[model samples]
Target: MSAKIAVKGLKKGFITDQGLLQVVNGISFDVADGEFVAFVGPSGCGKTTLMNIIAGFDPPDEGTVKVDGASRSGPSAKGILISQHGSVFPWLTVQQNLMFGLNGHAPSNKEQLADHYADLVGLKGFEMSYPHELSGGMLKRAELARALVVKPEILYMDEPFSALDALLSLRMRKEFLRILAEERHTVVLITHDVEEAIHLADRIFVLSARPAHIKATFAVPFEHPRRLSSPEAQGLKESILRELGV
Candidate 1:
């Protein structure tokens, strides 16, 4: 499989009151086209920083990040980053939010597209509803609808389900996997939830505590709608927990 995204010796740090604080230290990895990959690490381990650098939100101090074999110095038009907290316009109705990025299209065409994604994301009747009126899961589905409406080639999700309650997060994870299977967009997810990573990722990359680097990579062998209770899945979780030392 050809790599859709590649990073080599990527390094990033920030100016701190104490001094320069190195966060991502020589982190490197490749994401294959149409692949679902997860980065799992402790909190504040630069997982988000690494994600920001790859999505072109921040510049790397060293090395390179390439998408579709082209090095990127800034955010690519083909990529979209979904924040840990869902990104949606609080002021706009669900339909309007979906149409926000489709400005160049005809109004009728944009409406049609918004309706299509609204249905896909299970928000059909809630088109006129505002964000505050929705539940946590509904907000996420609405955000997904907004992102997918743009037809991005790659989706960079930063702990997308982190804000949801445990049960809601699990349900959303399943829903997300089903949607991704149909959409087949390459995904790079930054998450600290072990079970979430195990359930959704084709491969899981473990990063060490601060000055994060890839500590280990585990391939999830079971099929989607994975059995968290099954021995195989549980064992994989155990291995990952050992790597995390928690």
Candidate 2:
């Protein structure tokens, strides 16, 4: 449980007509290697903002973010951040889109890379399919494959399954969790779904309403494909809800 990723006094701001407005209010935390940790809170709670800073997509006006003891200034070889929205290039076919990210990393073995993730995400036969032709859930799976093919040390997921329907989302969640569990990739999830955070995360960091800071941290004890009806899972969710005053 060494600190693979650490955030210290992180602060971010945006310029507005009202002048500079702060978002992330010097929040701090640490993530252990091979740990699946999730950030949960209501909207405008700075969960995504803090995640962006950690991903190197957004810079903090004040504070520090380090991965493996090095300060991160941009997307690094140590990690990959999957944005909340689309990461796929619509003009490219599924294989092409997937291949685009893995290019030059493995050279002429690109097809093998494509097929590997295709199978990993259950998109084996649709490599030739275009993004526009695929459903929302499939697109997400493709993104997941793209990020994973690089074999990142840390995976930053910003509500990756929120776009799908209940059943599909559940399926995707189980599969995604299984892949990470199997791969042993350290992950930081930014989500609003308490049940989801509880189900897949080894540790959950709950944030305050806004100008966010850690309100509490909970450890989930259930195994993968954790049951929604499991007493432990249900009890954890209820505890979070009660704490959050939701």
Each model's lDDT: 0.92, 0.86
lDDT of 1 by residue, 61-117 (tens): 999999989999999988999987678999999999999998689999999999999
Candidate 2 residue runs with Cα over 4 Å from true position: 103-108
TM-score, model 1 to reference: 0.97
Stretches of model 1 off by over 4 angstroms after superposition:
none
- Candidate 2 lands at a TM-score of 0.95
- Model 1 steric clash pairs: none
Return the lDDT, model 1, position 132. Answer: 98
**Candidate 2 local Cα displacement, residue 5, angstroms:** 0.3
Which residue pairs collide in model 2, if any? none
Candidate 1 minimal-lDDT segment of 10 residues: 171-180
